[model samples]
Target: MAANGINSVALPPKDGFASGPLSPGEPAAPGLPLRSPNPLTSKVTSVLSTSYADAEFRDALGLLDERGLANSAETRRQLRLDIQKEVIQSNGDIITEFGRVADQLRRIGTTIDKLNRSYQEMKSHVTAAHKATSSTLDEASNLIAQRQDIEKKQHVLKALREHFVLSEDEEASLTLTSEPVDDRFFAILAKAKKIRTDCEVLLGFEHQTLGLEIMERTSKHLNQAFQKLYRWTQKEFKTLNLENPQINSSVRRALRVLAERPSLFQNCLDFFAEAREQILSDAFYLALTGTSPSGQEDRSVKPIELVAHDTLRYVGDMLAWIHSATVSEREALEILFVSDGNEIAKGIQAGRENDLWRLVTDEADGTPEFDAVKALNELVDRDVSGAARVLRQRVEQVIQTNEDTILAYKLANLLNFYRVTFSKLLGTQSVLLESMSNLETEALRQFRSLMRDHIATLQGEFQHTPSDLGPPDFLQESLKQLTSIMKTYETSLASTGDREADFQPVLAESFDPFISGCENMAKTIKPPSVSVFLINCLLVAKAALAPFDFTQKRVEALQSRVDEHAEKLVASQYAYLRTESGLDTLYDALAPLQATEEDIAKLRTSDALKPDVLIAASQNLDDFLPSALMDAMENLRHLQDSKLTRDITEEATEKFCVDFEHVEEMLISADEAIEQGQTNGHAGSQDGPQSLRALFPRTTGEIRVLLS
Candidate 1:
């Protein structure tokens, strides 16, 4: 032992051990057996063993603390000893626990080895099982994927069947059977049409046979359905009660559906028209004569013939009935034909008018169809044709038998009214419209004939013209008739074209002939009075006609005629004034002398133009001047218009003043020539006054004043 109290030291064995890393839960160093050899090696061993005792000494030294210092030596030593014993005992228990831990670790190692072996064994089984079932699992996955795809395909097929195929009952309702064309029928037809339309999508696919087959089947069904509707509609039309002009919904549906088939629709319209024609014909007879085709319809409403015994009223009532009937018929037809557009089959013949898509594509895969408005017009014309014929005969009969031109004119207006009404309701080329137009034309012809006959009678009766310069009685009566006729034209419904042009013929037939008759009657009136008579007649015509627009040209023409005759009257009045003033003879004598200066020189000494002759003419002028205006006015006193009398008097006076001025100039020239003659001593001394101023003392100024 060392002097410090370490007894022994532990060292490595003489066999020599290697130093390396330790395992888990290992001590810092392992125990080694010790053996003494040389003193040097023994010293290394002693030093090693002494290190263990040094640690114990260090702990024992710590036990000599503050408390330990106060303690007795024995107690302190005993405490150190207890501390060492406890340390040793605790280290022993630790060693014991470590040893038990080592045993458990060894057992755990064995179990782990068993577990790893079991794992090695089961891994091969798992691999083998996986290998065995891999294809089966893959097959199951593929089966699931295939099942999902099959479900999807099944869904698509179900949808396709619903889309492209009509059910059996729906098919039967549309084509196979004779059922009333109702909403159900229209519904089924609409479905069939949709199926056909959706087939276009089918056709877009590579397989188009399905689409083709569906389209073919649908087209056939549509044709058959339309044919049934057409025939049903036509048969229904045989008993169509147009008396109540409201259309039946079923009939309307049938017509709307049938319109999808244009040819069949047209045929149906023709059939309906034929049926209505007969029905309306009988209805017309009932209204006209209070007798049906069987002669047993209600006679409560008296015959139109009885109510309209007057010829104008008779034609008017008939035309009224026709117009009303045409309106009602058109309304019903519009209801039947022009409903809202079909969803599948548009009413387009080949294309919708204003459809922008129509430029790029033909939306209508259907056949050509007649326009609804056109077909409606055709039907209306045919339906009314029979009644129109009856009305025509009656109207022509009245126009022919009735001698009253005014009544005939009224009948013509009535026909024109209905004609225009029919044209609007049907069309301009409707047979009924054309017939009415013809009847109107005939009525006008009859009116003109009656007018001519009356004129002829008047011409035969009044062989001599009126003594007074006034409008003749026949002329006045003709003007009154013309005025009434013009009123009819003013209120007329049908304007052929330009207002002035259309009425030109009327003027030619009526007003022009009146003018001609007046001219013929005025022929017997001698000279001056003829102008006054024409003026009076023309003035009356202008006043009567100026108010109407269509007669504006006639009024203007009358004004021209009036002006013409007025000019003639003024001329005659001027001539009367000239003769009264004795300027007529002077003018005649001056006419030849005006050609040359030598003739002018001769005028002073000429017998016809001598100073004495000119003085005598002046004396006559002086006398005429006092009463010239009165005498001039007296010449036209027979003029019916006092205003016109004043106009003519003033015009005549102006003319006289002009002529007087001319006479004065020539007289002054003659006077100057006379003075020249006197200076040259050709005529020696002039007798009386030499200058015409002194000779014809009455100047043009004085004449104008007197006329004024």
Candidate 2:
């Protein structure tokens, strides 16, 4: 730098002044100062040290003094002046660039001012354009809303047509003359009904012409469908083969729907029941006559009347045939009635509710309050009514003509058996059951009449009962017949609603008369044998009645009678003991005494009861005591039961012993009276001497041992 700028170090001897600064390490010229005048001045590296802001200053700074030492103050002052000149030159160039930028900024401001005025000119034209299109846009919007509303109304109209109108194919299924009545027919019929109902809702609107038209059309279709169902049901019923005991669901549903028209439904039922009745009546005639209703001989099955030659068998065969037919008929009809009985009830109930159903009903017909079970039972009863009538006639003839009371009861039991059977199959209110019941009552009446006439013959005749105190042969024979009748009744299937009440008349007619005859005969027997005879009769009656539940009270009554006669036997035996054992005289003496017997000491004052008489009676008792019980029992030996005889004997012996004790007490009182007289110095009061221990020597304990 010193070579390029001012050199403070002199060049070698260039006239004693530096033409150039020193190169490299050259010494300074003599007398030249090498020290900087301001030490900080040489320490300065550059005036434009951050030359990156202006790259032009970098070259200019290097051209200035790289002076290392100061020679004089004038030389340092020239270096300061050079640095100040460079700074002033650089500031002038920056000011010159600012002046060019200020010109360009003014030109841009002028351009922005002109564009702002042009935008103001376009604003009014755009607002005028918007104003011109507003009315057209409002009209277009109104047109779009109207178009959407019309499309919505079209959709609503399509839905209404589908809901209120039936297709031709669907209508044909219900109303077409050639269409068969079936499940599909019924389904379309039901749809027509629902549309008719929905039309009612449509009728609520102000303009109801559509509702009225659709309802009229649907009602016509419903009527046609129901008419088809009715004719189909009637046709099916005419050909119904009830042998299988089943009805199809289609036919069952048809019946349920047709029931809404009461006159039509009732007419169909009347025909079915009538056909069944005629068919069964013919079958019964064939069963009876061995010939068909058309007069052909039926060789396949034997005629019931021919096989059953006897009266009871003929009647039983008729009833059995009726029962079998009733079962088959009931089994076939239950599918229509009992199995779906509630459906019949509901159908009638619904018919009563429907105004449309009311229009078809005949006012004179009693069809509104129909009972399904009653209707079924009546129908079945009618079907077998012919057979039931024949059965009643045959059974009544047999029962009424039957002279044998036993056979009459057997017929009664047979009638009751069939009566119960028909009641179970048909019900208690059944006509067949009522006829059988009347027949049963007639048979029982015949039984009772025969029994009464037979009993009357025995009572009116003077036939002697056997001499042996026993039930007569007539009673035994009647009882045997009664037993046979009872066994037949026991096995019979008669209703046991109140068996005791029902059979009590039979007992009274057949049994009570014989018992009364026995009592009459017992009255003619000898007095001692009367109780034994009655006891024997009642015991026999009781044994016969013991095995049956219905005869429990009768058995109890017989037992009570037997016991009553047994009490009489016991009393007779006790009386015999009192007489035979000499205790009767002592009891006679003691009979008049007070209950406490305060006057017993004075009993010896009576001559009949004196001490010697008491000794005589006591002596007689001593003789009787050895075999007292034996003698008492021997008196009642004719009693049928040995146990009863023994029991009567013991009771009598105890009574005898009790009387002996009383006599001994009386004798002791007499002895004490004599002693009191003798101690008071009057010895005459001791009547003829006999001690109490000596007289009446037997004690009650001894008597009990002997009796046992």
Judged by whole-model lDDT over C-alpha atoms, candidate 1 comes out at 0.74
Q: What is candidate 1's lDDT per residue for 1-708, written digit by digit as tens?
A: 121221111122335542222344554445653333354665566456755446655543454443335556566455555545765787799999999999999999999999999999999999999999999999999999999999999999999888778778777887755666678888888888888888899899999998999999898888888777777787788877665656576776666555555467657766777788887788888999887878686858689998887777888888888887787777776666565463112443333332211112244654333345665677677888888889888877887888888888888877777777777777776788788878888988998898778767776635556778677777788789888988988888746467778878777777777777788878877778999888888998898899988778778888998899888888888789878888888877766556357877666566766677877887887887888888888888889898888888888878777766776787777677657666777565546345667767777777778889
For candidate 2, the per-residue lDDT at 377 reads: 75
Clashes of each: 2, 0
Pairs in steric clash, model 2: none
Least accurate 10 contiguous residues by lDDT in model 1: 1-10
lDDT per residue for candidate 2 within 1-708, as digits (tens), equals 323222322222344644333454566667976744443544353233434454444433444434454657666567656655765777799899999999999999999999998887788787888799899889999999999999999999888777777889888888776888777787777778789989989999999999999999888888887877777887888788888665677777776777777777777677777788888888988998899989999799799878988877888788888889998887777787556656755775676542222323465655565556666777788778877776667677777778998988988899888888778777888778899889988988888889878987887532465667777888888889989988887897655677767678889988998888888877776756888888888888888878888788889989898888887887787788778766676788775664344665557566657557767877886787778777766666666678877776776567766766666666666667656657687655655556555655666677667666
RMSD of 1: 9.4
For each candidate in turn, give its C-alpha RMSD to the true structure in angstroms: 9.4, 10.7
